[model samples]
Target: MAEKEAVEATVTGNDQQVGFRAMVMKQAIAYNLAGSARNDANEIVHFTLQGDKHRIDSALATLQEGTKRSSDIKIATTSAAIDPGLNAFTIVDWTSSSRNITNTYNLVFELRADDTAISPTDAKAAWHQILEKTLNADDLKKLQPND
Candidate 1:
């Protein structure tokens, strides 16, 4: 199915604060939200994201910590025509006097899982690569089994 192009995700909590912007940016980038965010005088964090539906959904889900404070987050959607030329989702600089971005959208292809791990060595290396790449994902941690 074809995915939507634009998403207006309004994250909650610390919206009136400056440091929270960094936290939101990190989480959004990890999930590949191509847009920008900044704190406004109305205490609302305005975010303009242009990306695939799955990536945008994933970013929104991450922002919802299930806490009371996080529940305040809200989002509104509409059909938008975007230039599908972006290489990847990114956080654009919002410091410019004009808060505008060269909007572009691209379908992010998922890597196939190495289910061909028929051997222990192969399985180890495949899993190792997955873990190593996840280093930048703060939301991801060392895998643990049910003790």
Candidate 2:
């Protein structure tokens, strides 16, 4: 049998809003690889895969392509020592971590004689409304600005 290998990768760019982690987990399971994936505060998706060398290479190719919702995805990989105890792949939720990031929405309103520029309060409200439609409650909570 071929020697097993481990790899750690960071995937960046348009990876957040999409179901990137779930997709990656599915692929990892399909390859019978063991490890975990999570989103970091910097909006990067970090993951580790360990298994047969050939399977790891194939998984890397799938990850680099990314899910349909992902765009401009770039993946960086490095060799890692395999963890003998790893048995299953999972999505690591870092919502409780201090590193959790709040998403800031900015809207620039142009002043016009016919239309008044939007007030800061109104702009903030509008931004939250957009988030409500696009993000889940948990994700919305993480986006709350620090006082």
Candidate 3:
């Protein structure tokens, strides 16, 4: 049997709010890949896939060819170490969790609109708080300036 391979990809450009994740999930499932796909706050679609080398390559190729709703899709891919425990492909709903930054931001806005104790300044503070909690070490590195 051929050794399985893994890949991590970030797809940007007209790839959000247009069922891009669903499309990618469908392709991954069809290719018998195991992994997950989700959209980040910046509208980038991040995905990880593990499967036969040929099938992974084919899926990536299909993804680069944007869906009907997507335009000018750009994808960046990198080889990833395969996770032996991954069982099936899935689409993660990051925003549904209260811990998610997007959800926190939405809550802040809702509180402000409801004429609650949350003032405009409080909303801004909430935004910063959520941003800090949400950004991981990798995200912080990306935001750092070159010395």
Candidate 4:
């Protein structure tokens, strides 16, 4: 309950990071979501996600799936409750970095749903799906430093 409103979830990946914001302003717009991205000092990224559960979900999916550069990555998600007054779901601004762990970065996200906010559990759920699409065992192994 708590009058669900927004969902702020954080993501972690390879030595780089990025975030997504600005709710799906354009009706049925392309999946090309927009926001900000950066390189954190902690080797971990910090990004935000602002949009409906579906929008954020799909975007996160992309992150998990990854691009041509990076491959499967280890991730963690922490959820936060939001207000119920937001008109539409929109990602605000993302703060990323590359110093979370060794050869890893931090990922932070702020998302909006219908009434209340999405719980960390739910956030991780969505993030988990994204990771599944993006990462694999080899990707996770290579990120490790020389043992």
Candidate 5:
């Protein structure tokens, strides 16, 4: 079998509040890739693609093409460690209820887990549990960077 590869992609500009993440998920699924997509506090869309290099490249092509609502799209991709645990592509929810940097870090750590079998959803839930034990909602709000 061909070596499985992965890429960490950060997409900015006209990528948020649209269906870009969902569209990317669809493309990734069509390509049979495994990874995730989510929007960040700064209106940036971050995603990861893991699987065959050719398929990843194909998905990247479609992503670069942009959705109808997307303009000025800029995507930066770096080679990433393959996550063998990701069984399917998913769109993670990034709500503004408690937008702390820790949430992003947790998601990043989960996505980059090279030796674990935990899914992103499971990992995020576990991270939330840690936060629940250590901090209240008000404390989490304090951790959010000042606008």
Candidate 6:
């Protein structure tokens, strides 16, 4: 059997909202690796790839190539402990309500209430309520510049 290894990589650049996570997942699956990818609020994508060391290196090279939608891709990798229980590659969504709808809609919704079980509709409604209460017409007028 081949030697197995794992690596955690942080990719910085124009990596968000560009199908970058999906591309990483596909490459990891193709390499028979197990781990995950996620995007942070700062627009960086992180990856955990575990399998054969050589295959991981290959995937890293391909990652350097970047997707058509991604540019200025830069990756820094570190050794990681192999996860014997991880059997597939997946995308880990950021756990924040402040994320834009494009990224938050399809994943789990997290809020100050600490309820991850809330449906998307409920989450949206909760956010709307918070905004309505916090930013009434008077508040908006106050925020406006005094002319």
Scored by TM-score, the top model is: 6
Candidate 1 vs candidate 3: the lDDT winner is 3
Clashing pairs in 6: none
- Model 4 TM: 0.38
Candidate 6 per-residue C-alpha lDDT over 61-134 given as tens digits, one digit per residue, 9 for 90 to 100: 98888878789999999999997777656567532222232223222112222212234344335434433454
Q: Against the hidden true structure, what lDDT does model 1 obtain?
A: 0.43
lDDT of each: 0.43, 0.63, 0.62, 0.36, 0.64, 0.62
TM-score of each: 0.45, 0.62, 0.62, 0.38, 0.62, 0.63
Q: Compared with the true structure, what per-residue lDDT tens digits does model 3 show for residues 5-80?
A: 9999999788875657656665654556678887777768999888778877877887898878789899899999
lDDT of 4 by residue, 1-147 (tens): 222223334444443432221112121122222233433456454444333556556556645655344555543444545444333223222222221223322232333323344443455454434333444444444332310
Error of 3 at 19 (Å): 1.2
Show where candidate 6 strays beyond 4 Å: 94-147
Backbone clashes under 3 angstroms, per model:
0, 0, 0, 43, 0, 0
Residue 53 of model 6, lDDT score? 83
A best-first ranking of the candidates according to their lDDT comes to 5, 2, 6, 3, 1, 4
Alpha-carbon RMSD of each model:
11.5, 17.2, 15.9, 13.2, 9.0, 12.5
- Cα lDDT tens digits, model 1, 12-74, are 553432333433454444544455565456656666666557766665665554323334444
Error of 3 at 18 (Å): 1.4
Better of 2 and 4 by TM-score: 2
Q: List the residue pairs that clash in candidate 5.
A: none
